[model samples]
Target: MNGNRFGRLFQVTTYGESHGEAMGVTVSGCPAGLELSEEDIQRELDRRKPGQSMITTSRGEPDEVVINSGLQDGYTTGTPIGMVIQNKDARSGKYEPYVTAPRPSHGDFTYSAKFGTRNWGGGGRSSARETVNWVAAGAIAGKILDQHGIQVKAHVNQIGDIEAPPVSFEEMLEHTEENEVRCAHPPTAEKMRERIDQYQQEGDSIGGSIYFEARGVPRGLGAPRFDSFPARLGQAMFSIPATTSVEYGLGKEAREWTGKDRNEDWEFDAEGDPIPEGNKHGGLQGGITTGQPIYGEATWHAPTSIPKQQKTVDWETGEEKEIQVVGRHDPVLPPRAVPVVEAMLSLTILDFMLLGGRINPDRLDGTAGEYDTEYHPSSPDNE
Candidate 1:
């Protein structure tokens, strides 16, 4: 409940439940005078909305976004931006059985233990549907970062045991959206799709990882130890429902190598700036960015919700039961999670950028007492 808010300077507080009437977010600390529209946020929401493709859920929510505050004539006013997306497809009947039985591997039991009671419909605040708010807030952060040439992108790199070959950032941007799996490799995406279909047909689910990258991020945007870039990034990724592990740079593979093999030596770019000979460090050095592309992977466990019959104890009756979690659910998560990953990345980097003084926190143009921003509305008297 207390943790619904995220960020320090650039903050977002999300509200509403999975089966609630609507989901919404309030974003504060964004600089004033940036051009933002409902369409900008809606575009990102569309990517993560339910029922998008065969691999996704069958729910038919359109995920339409409406910006209700914090703008004037299409420009941000440096105040809190409020946006809402209504839940039009919620069906609670199927979820009723699990209200007392507690779904396996889900937050149901824990939520009840903590709150003494829960919404129990569509998993309430714990459902992945809550991520819709994150995608919306990230869209605004993406717009803020866009003005500074910072680009964030992500792709499904692995589904179950089918791992995609490493891809370039350009490939991720160009080919990620081409397939239902959202993998950059076309042939691999086909394989992933087929694999997902196999699981869907079996009434089961699978897990996977997402490879995310941020380009044009400045160095020294993070502090050592606690407030480090990777630390914050890890928190953001792990907060997503079902995320099991997160790793940066060489990640878990580095454990097999000696220090010499893992260490990245320093070199100079054409501009004479210090750079790394290799990016094994994943664009981060000692918790601060190295002015190189920050890249990593976040792994999600198989979704807990499955039609396959699962066993659990009925807390109220003290009896055991087998239940089929039949409802609209995704067989695999990474495809729809792609935008959520990007949104968190954008939000994290933009917050750091503002904290590092790389961008003006008061105005997008970095100039105080000036209404001359490119996004500012102009009078038609001259026309």
Candidate 2:
């Protein structure tokens, strides 16, 4: 519970359980005077809400976020912004069976081992349900990013065996969210949807990958070592439930390159700014942003809440048993996980931006790093 917080300057501490009365997040370290509203947070929750498609959970969370405090006159006061979303549709009874029989590939066993108790309903804090809190905080960070001309977007590039055709950043933005799966290619999305439907019929689940891109990001946002940009991004994405792998730029493909291929050449853009010709380094070099579009990919495995019985040990009896988890869950993760990828990126980047003294709350309009000249006299970034 202590580690619930994410970020150093732009901190977010999430609270509540999957079946708890209300889930929420408290955002701290956001600069004062940014325009904010519950609607801003609600819009994000809507995208992350359950039951958007047949491929997703049918449970209607309605996930309507209510601003509890920290805003007056439609602007953030720079205090802790607290928001909550009530769980009106959760059916705790359905998860009762999972209490004694922990499901495989889930946090039930580990959580109990760590806390000496666990919320059997909906995997408690271990549930991806907790991601809603992240999306809420990310929405605020996104509002800040917007003023800075930074845009964070994600796409379901692959679902199960269906892979979207290669797409450019512009193409993904233009058409990624046009479909439920959030894929850039329409044909690939259709096939992906059909695959999810097929899995639903089989009472099973599948897994796939998502790609996140952050555009217009200011250079030098990452801290050196320890909290490196890619390291921070990796930790954030890997925290999501069922996210098994994470890679940036060429990722694993970097291993196939020779010394010549590994070396990148910098070319001047229209503004005469440096841009990497070959971004096998993924818009980052020396653990910091390199003024190029930052791209990352994460692979999530199948949901454990499947109809098929799986072998597991009973926590209470220590006896082996089969558990056919009964509950509504996504047929695949990428469709719903798209927002989460964006959320983590927004939160992590904003935190780093804050630490690097990039945010200028007073300016209301301008890119993040544009305010560096207006830094506090006592601040190190000013010298």
Candidate 3:
């Protein structure tokens, strides 16, 4: 709970539970006079909301965001931005059986052991639903980045064992939105969809990797030594539910390559600026952005709420029993995770930019027309 707050300059603290009456976030340190509306937050929420497709959960919550504070007319007031999304479709009845029988792969048992009490209803705060607040905060952070020409995009790169071919950020932006799986490769998306369908039918689930790329990121946006750019990005990425692993650039593959192959060679550009032919370092050298795209990948495990019966011990009886998971769940998590990953990237970059003195704090006037309109919400790849 202490770690719920994130960022240095532009900070956010999220509250509420997965099956509670409502979930919300309090955003502080925002500059005044930025163009913001319910639609701005809703657009991102729609993407993060469950029941969007067959591959995601069937929970019918509308996930509509209500801005209770932080704005007057159509812009931020620089105060704590409070927003809430009500839990309209939660089925607590499905969770009655799990009150004592904690589900595996979930935080139920561990949370109970740590806190001495647990909200057995729909995994409580541990559910992926907790990420809705993050998606909302990320949307605001994204708006801040957009004002400064920074763009973050993510796509499902691998589903289980099926890996999509390497694609550029622009190509991914164009093609990822074309399919439900959100992968740039049409063929791989089809295969992944088929596999997800098979798993859903068998009452099981699958996991995969997502690739995120940050474009138009300025240099010198991260601290040197401790809080490196990639290190901060990885920390935020792992904050998401089910995120098991994270890596930047060549990631673990660098272990197989010699220093010459793994290290990026810097050369002088036409303007005498440093540029690298290959991004083997993932755009960050010495824990700072190198005026190149910052790229990273995250791997998530399958959701634990599969219908397949799993063994669990009944705490009251002190005997083993099989649990048939109920309630809506995702057959695969990568597709839905694309936006979540992008949000984290946006938050991290914006935080670093603010910390690095790249973003002008005076520019936050909360008036839509006051800020410069240099960047639009169009695909970053096209730019």
lDDT of candidate 1 over 1-383, digit per residue (tens): 57888887788999989889999999988888999899999999988988888889999999999999999999999999999999998998889998889999999999999989999899999999999999999999998888889999999999999999999999999999998899999999999999999999999999999999999998888989978999999899999998999998889998898999888788889999988898888899989999999999999989889988778999999999988889899998999999999999999998788777787778876675533212211433111
Clashes of 2: 0
True lDDT of residue 358, candidate 2: 72
Best lDDT among the predictions, by candidate number = 1
lDDT of 3 by residue, 143-260 (tens): 9989888888989999888899898888887998899999998999999899889888988998999988989998777767767887788789999989999999889898899987
lDDT per residue for candidate 2 within 101-200, as digits (tens), equals 7788888778888888888888888889999999999999999988889999889999887888778888888998799989988899999889988998
Q: Report the Cα lDDT for residue 132, model 1.
A: 97
Give per-model CA RMSD.
Answer: 6.2, 3.7, 6.2
lDDT to native, each model: 0.90, 0.84, 0.84
Off by over 4 Å in 3: 365-383
Q: Could you tell me the TM-score of candidate 3?
A: 0.93
Candidate 1 least-lDDT 10 residues: 374-383
